[model samples]
Every structure is written in C-alpha cells, then in structure tokens.
Target: MTTRIDTRFAELAHKGRAALVTFLMAGDPDPATSLDIVKAMPAAGADVIELGMPFTDPMADGPAIQAAGLRALGAGMTLKKTLDLVRAFRAGDDTTPIVLMGYFNPIYVYGVDRFLVDAKAAGVDGLIVVDLPPEEDAELCLPALAAGVDFVRLATPTTDDKRLPAVLKNTAGFVYYVSITGITGTATPDFGRVAAAVARIKRHTRLPVAVGFGVRTAEHAAAVAQGADGVVVGSALIDVLKATLGADGQASAGTVPAVARLVGELAAGVRSARRAAE
Candidate 1:
C-alpha cells in the first residue's frame, strides 16, 4: 500500500532536497484567510504543511500559538471546520502534503475512526498529536495507520536511547525531533545538541527526521538542517504571523507576504547549509 506522506516525502529525499514544514492555526481570524495562507506556503518552498488544530489548552505552545488557538476558537473553528480547510486546500493542490498538528482530545472527541475517515477524505496525510506517547499508540495510532495517515512521532532531546526504538516503531511520515524540551516559539537553539539528538534517532530508524521547537530564523534553520532530513520552523513563523496579524490574528499589512517570504528564505538557508557541507 502506498502511504500518502511517505511517498510524497520520498520524492524529496531521493532528490536530496531539504523539506520545509510550516505550522499555522486552522482558522486564525477566519477559515478563508487561513486557507489562503496554507495555499500560499507551497509556492513559497514548503514541502509539507503542518495545519495546527487549535486547542484551548495548548500546553506545548508558547504565547503566539496559544493566542492563535484562542483566535481560531473564537472564530468558531471546530474540528469539522479544520478538516474543511484541508479539503479546501486539497481542492487547489493535491500533491503538497498536509499534516494535522494538535492534541488527541479533539481527535478522540471526534471519534478516531470517524476522524480518520474525514481527514483522509479532506486530503490530510498525517497527524502530530503532541501528547500521544508511544506506549499509548494503540488508542489512535493503529486506526491512523490503517486509514493511510502517518502517525508522526515527536522525539525530544530528552528521549533516552533505550526508548528511541519504541518511539520510532511503526512511525511513518517523519520523526519530529524537538530541538528543545520546552514549548514552541522560544528562541535560538544550540545545534550541537540538536545534531547529537538527530544522530541518536537515526541510529534506530530510517525515517526522515525534522527538528523543531525554538527555530526562528534562516540562520537557525541552516544550522540544524545541515544534519537533518528536514527543518520544522514553528514558533518563529507563528511569531511573524502574530506580529503581522496582531492580537486579532489577522494578517497585518504585508504580513501574509512576509510570512511566505520568510518560509522561502529559511528553505533557501537549508539549501545553503547543504552546499557548505559539500
């Protein structure tokens, strides 16, 4: 069976190109604009789009993402609406991968089987449940994989090598390597430790590893992407969105274009890292 994410990502890996994964709230000010942001990202060099399913209590997120979540919720963004956005994005482009990033409460609230069916129908290729540990994989992991969605796992720097195998088992899409053990949108990270963490994860799995958490600039992205299969930039991007969109989370003047430009710049930074390494 051909997996949606694995196949799409394999094309990039074979060509030895770095993947840029962007994270944004489902409905910032409204669904239409958020969908527009999603649509704009692919052309700006995003290999995979991580559509953040806003939760009231986003413990893993920082100020920017939390506020984005509240705004999405206030705008009447629901689980159903998020899937609708994915369906809408799929309407225009069927190739660029879309991964739903959120907590499992909404998934369980919507019913795992039902949610999987809806997600696939909407063209979503994967999921990133922040609290779903490998030990509790059966709850949604099994159904997620069976439905053709990759249940992507997050391996933090603190994850012990003894437990890396369990975290990686049956994991597809890509392994999200959290550069730091804190919330998203922090600050620049020490790539030395990030590099070591990537090596440790690679020791156990062949899946592509994209590191995130506190990645905020092209320089930071280049630093980590030098040894990573991909670089996941969230907080920085969300920060840009917040700065441009403001508390209302609407795209500030030139905010949408600015965000797109930054994504493209960071992706180019990854390429620069590749060239320097060569």
Candidate 2:
C-alpha cells in the first residue's frame, strides 16, 4: 500500500530534488498559533511535515525541542489534542504527509490499538516513536505497520552493519538517519560523513533516507540535501518559534511568520541541491 509518505518521496525523486521535512511541536506557544504555523508550512515549501507529539520527558529531544514540548504541555496539549491538531490540519491540506514524531509513553497510555485507529482517522501517515527499538517490534512497530501507519526507524552513527538489517527489517515510510550522536540540535554533522552514511544505508534498503539533527541553516540543509533523500529541520525551527514568542511564552505576532520565513529559506536550500548537482 503506497502511503502519502511514499508518494511524496516518489514525487520529489521524480522532480530530482530532496524533500524538505519540517518539524514543530503540536502546541508550542498555543494551539491556535501552532495550527497556523503548520498550515503555512507547505506554502513555505515543506514537502513533509513532522508534527511533534509533546511528551513530559522527551529523552531524544534537545533543549529547544524540550522547551517547545513543555510550552505545549503547559498549554494543555495532550495526546488527544495532538491528534486533533492533525485532524484539523487535514481538513484543509490532505496531500501533505503528516508524521507524528515523539516517544511511546503517551501511545502506550492511550492504548496502541485505539491510538492507531484514531491516528489513521486523523490522517496521520507515519510515526517516529524514538523509544521503541526493533527488538520490541510487537509492542508497537509491527502493530503500527499492520494498522497501515508507517513506523519510521532511526539509524545513528553507532548502528553498525550487523544492526542495520534489524533496524530496517520492518521500517516503513522512510529511515531517519541521525546525523549527530547526541540529542537533536546539539552539534553540527560532518557533511562528508553524512553523505557516506546515507550511501551506506541506501545499500541496505530501498527506502528513502532523511538526515536530521543539527541542521540549522539553509546552507546546512543544502549540504545534507546533496546526499540525503530528505533534509529534516526541527530544532532550528523550534528555536525560531521560541524566539518569536512573547516574554510570557505565548505566541507573538511574529511567531507564525518567523517559522514560515525560515522554512522557506531552508526549502530553497534543499531545492538548490539538485540544481547544483545538475
């Protein structure tokens, strides 16, 4: 079954350019503003949208993303509300793939079966549960696949050849290659090493590989886009949104525009990669 994710990547492939996958918390400053920011992403050139499912303890997230999650939770951004956000986004734009990126606790608490049903109904195309490894496939990964939602797996620098197969065994939609070793947005990745890593992973699976972590600028996105099938920008966007917030941590007039502006710049960078190659 070809999902929205598969279709989007295929479309980008045909266009000879990498995808610009944008990420943001579901209700960072406030739900209304958050929705506005998301709705503006596609027009800003985001080929794929990874909406964060804010959790109490996002172990994989960096400071910017962690703070974004806190602000979301503070504004009562529950798991259900996050799904509702997706549902609302789908009302206007159904073609843009929406991937719920976060940990697994909330899903477990909400009951995986029920969550998958609701997520599908809400038009969620994929999921990136950082905590669930390939070892625990039955817990959520396999079930998610069966439920028709792509479970995107992450591959870090530490994942050796022996472990790559297991990681890619049931992974669907795409494989997220963590360019840095630590949490999101902490360090810059060596573009050379990232290219080699993407090449190495491609040797193992036909799935598109998206490189993320520490991609802060258009130049950084361009560099990764040269080798990666997609370039993901999360922390940088969160940082921009945070900066646009008021002193009370609420969305200011500049919030949505700020994020939209950055996404546009990053998308241009990603698009430039193919032209440079040509």
Per-residue CA lDDT of candidate 2, range 93-184, in tens?
Answer: 98999999999999999999999999999999999999999998999999899999999999999999999999999999999999989999
Candidate 2 wrong stretches, greater than 4 Å:
275-278
Clash numbers, per candidate: 1, 0
lDDT of each: 0.84, 0.94
What C-alpha root-mean-square deviation, in Å, does candidate 2 show against the real structure? Answer: 1.3
Candidate 2 overall Cα lDDT vs. reference?
A: 0.94
Clashing residue pairs for model 1? 244-252
Error of 1 at 51 (Å): 0.7
Clash-forming residue pairs, model 2: none
TM-score of 1: 0.95
Off by over 4 Å in 1: 246-249, 275-278
